[model samples]
Target: MVPIDTPTLGDRSYLAHDGSVALVVDPQRDIDRVLALADEAGVRIAHVFETHIHNDYLTGGLALAEATGAAYHVNAADEVSYARTPISDGDVVEVSPSLRVRAIATPGHTFTHLSYALESVSDDGIEAVGVFTGGSLLFGATGRPDLLGHEHTSDLVHHQFSSAHRLADELPEHTHVLPTHGFGSFCSAGSTGDTTASTIGAEKRQNPALTQDEEKWVADTLAGLDAYPAYYAHMAPGNSTGPSAPDLSTPESADKETLATRIASGEWVVDLRTRTAFAAGHVTGTLNFGVDGQFATYLGWIIPWGTPLTLLGESPEQVAEAQRELVRIGIDHLEGAATGSPQDWTDAPLGSFERAVFADLAQVRHHREVSVLDVRRTSEFDEAHISGAVNVPLHELLDRVDEVPSGEVWVHCAGGYRASIAASVLAARGVHVVAVDDSFDEGAKPSGLPIAAA
Candidate 1:
């Protein structure tokens, strides 16, 4: 078994085979990665399985199955428009003489979610290998139950608790617990810790879903969830209707004037450079969503859906990487792109901002009046934050930019990523701003600044 990880989005797709034929689970929209892995392993992809219609990313299962001429397996209850080999609880698929998969009803992440348990058929008799607990059972957590909407959260969370216990009770302790979410995906209801692999025995001892009572687990899980990306609203619909392969070909190159025009016309002209490099010099009005740092998640969270987007990267590769991230979230197309330095993009004087540390913020605070903006989520801010800092999260910053008080605004997130994004938004509006480009725990807490809890 080989796990294909999408760390930025905190999800995994698995490819398991019996030396000749392979079955894939929860593939991302880019099918090329899966195809390459299969070809390198000298195996044919015979089956594609989805634990559920994903809410985080458009599934590549249908596209990959179509490309490989494989059988596509999805829940029989899903109201998808595409034709698929309908699977339900208790149904078993014999992939080869050595490999077979049994579907187990584990609806928690979604109403019709199913987990597939791999069984190895041997001369000694059939033995279970592991179960693909997509969003139902994660590393140390379970999938968040709120993605379906507030109306279903209560029932689904209860269902999530029951589903997790069911897996722990039914699967053998030695059976591997391979899950699709919890690596870093927002689908996780709590922390997944840092482990790479786990077994049912380990999960039963450590996972919140397995250790806590259903009532407490449901309450804690719901309380721990912060806002997920706005683009999530589009993922299920895109997956259900069957999305085609993304057009990853380089977008039409935009000149300086075109980029300016797009920015002026209320389009998102994003700068995909390093936050430090972006702060040094960038075209005025271009928002910074550095490709190096959770680019798609924050960008997709903030950008108005279906708005025309143009990327400004330092290279063609950067632009392409950003394009790939966008496509996974169902942002299929880019308006245009421009690669190279700010100088290459524009002859006009570029916008610039100060990139400081927590110490600098403290020093500046002592000397002059400045508005300190904390751009982390409200839950994060409430846990602890620098005293007197205005709490407008990065996702809500654009809409609430006016709420940020006038004068020099110094912004910081837990780390520096979201701070740069917030700084860019402020700088674009001609607000004097500085990005605290250092770790909060490693910098802010130790920098002798006053920390307070809400």
Candidate 2:
């Protein structure tokens, strides 16, 4: 079994083979990576599986199956527009002489979710090896049930608990547990822990769905779920209709005047650079969504859907990388891109902002009137935050910008990443902003700032 991990989205795709023929599970929009992996393994992809209609990233399943002429396997009950070899619960497919796949109905993440049990066939007998739990069962937690919508959350959580127990009871104790979400993806109900490896036996001992009662498990899981990406609203619909392969081609090059015009017209001119570099200098009215951070997730969450996007990067490679990330969330094409220093992208004195650590924020508070802004989720702010800090999550910042108290606003999150994104948005909107570029626990809690519980 070979796992293809897309860390940015905190999801993993799997490829299992019998040395010659392989089956792929939950591939991302970029099929090239999976194709390259199969090529490197010297195996022909004979099947592609969708554990569920994904809500996080566009699936590359249809495109990959078409590309490889392989049988695409989706749940029989899934309302999809494309043709696929629909598999139902208890149905088993012989992928090759030595490999077999059995579908198990494990609806929770979605109403039609299925987990595939991989078995190795031999002259001795057929033995189950691993189960691809998809969004149903994760490493330590289960997938969040609220992604479908608030109306379905309660019913889904109950199903999620039952599905997890079903996997534990039916699968062998030693059977490896493979899942597609919960690495850092918001789809997870709770922490997934640091280990990448787990088995049914281990999960039974530690997983809440296994250890806790159904009522307790449901309550805890529901309580733990926070806000997920806003772009998730578009993913399942895009996947159900069968999205085509992503267009990763380089966009048209834009000069300084073009970038200026686009920004003036309210197009999203994003800077793909470090927060420090972006704070040092960047094109006026352009927002910073450093490519090295969770660039696509935050950018997709905050930007208006279908808005023209132009990327400004220090190098062509940076812009290219951003394009790939954006496509995973179904932002397929770019309006344009510009690469080079801020001076090269703009003739006017480039826009700039102040980036400070928590220590600086602590010292600055004593001297002047500054509105402290916490850009983390509501749950995070509720647990602990700087005393007197206004809570406006980064995802909701754009729409609730006026709620932020006026004056010099000092923005922060659990880490520096979200803070920088918020700072950029506020800066672009003419709010005096200072990004707190430090860990909240290591910085704010100990930096002489009065931390208070909401």
Candidate 3:
């Protein structure tokens, strides 16, 4: 077994093989890595299985199946447009003479979710070894059930409760629990303390969704759900119809004149430099989405779907890395890229923003007509924040920029990553941005700024 971890998305795909035959589960859109792993393992891929119509990232199941002549398996209930082996609850597939995988319908995150349990078959009969619990039962939490939208939240919460119990009841205590959506994934209702690997026995004892009272579990899960990226809306539909195979070829390189033309035409020009470097100097009108931060999530959230985008990075490597992140969420309309400093690329006057700490803001807030924009989530704002700060969650900033009062704007989130993103968005719109690029804890003190509950 090999676990292919995409750290940016906090998602995992697996290759389970018994000597000569292999089965892939929940693969991401980029199939090259899976293919490389299979080649190294000296096994031919025999099947590809999708847990559900993924709402977070594009799936490469159809493309991989076509490439390798493997049978692609998907839940019949999903009614996906692509041709696939329609798998249902309790369907067992024998991948090799010794390995058998059985499908378990575990719908909660989506209506068509399925979990596959791997078993070892021998003369002593089938012995279960592990299970791919895909968005149903996570390590220390259950998958959030509200991805289908507000109308289905309560109904899916009920289903999630039943599904968690079902997994705990049916699987052996020793069965290894491998999930696709818990390790820092936004699909989870809340943080799971960063746990990545566990067994059914441990989850039964530690997972709140498994141990808590059914009603209380559902209530807590529903209450803690946070807003996800806007790009998520396009993923399920794209996957349902079978997303086109990702084009991993390097994008065209844009010269200084080409980049200028694109920017003048109102296309998105993203700077993949460090936040500090971006704040020091950048091409005017370009938004800074640092390569080191959560680049894809924030970029996808703010950029309109199908908008032609071009990237400016320090090197070809940085641009390529950012491109990979962008394609994971199906943002494939990359027009081109340019690699150089602002001075090297263009003669336009460089733009910059003021970086400040919370304590510095405490002094400035009393004197100037400044507006503090809290870009954290609503829940974070409700806990404690600067008494007069306006709440505009980072994910919704592009749509609600008008709500942020004019004048010198100070933006911040729990950490500096979101604050940088918010600052860049505001800066791109010609708003004077002061990025509070430091820890929120240092700024939340009473001595630094007056604190109040939302």
Give lDDT per model, in order. 0.93, 0.92, 0.88
Candidate 3 ranges with C-alpha deviation above 4 Å: 363-369
TM-score of 1: 0.99
Model 2 lDDT per residue over 117-235, tens place: 99999999998999999999888899999988899999999999999999999999899999999788888998998879899999999998899999888888888888888899999
* TM-score of each candidate structure, all chains considered together: 0.99, 0.98, 0.95
C-alpha lDDT of residue 365 in model 3: 73
Clashes of 1: 0
Q: In model 2, what is the error at residue 49, expressed in angstroms?
A: 0.4
- Give one digit per residue, the lDDT tens place, for model 3 in 368-416: 7798999999999998988889999988887898999998899989878
Candidate 1 lDDT (Cα, 0 to 1): 0.93
Model 1 / residue 379 / CA error / Å = 0.3
Model 1: per-residue lDDT, tens digit, 229-339?
A: 888998999989998877799899999889878888989899999999999999999899999988888898899998999999989999999999999998988899999
lDDT of model 2 at residue 91? Answer: 95
Q: Residue 177 in candidate 3 has what lDDT?
A: 92
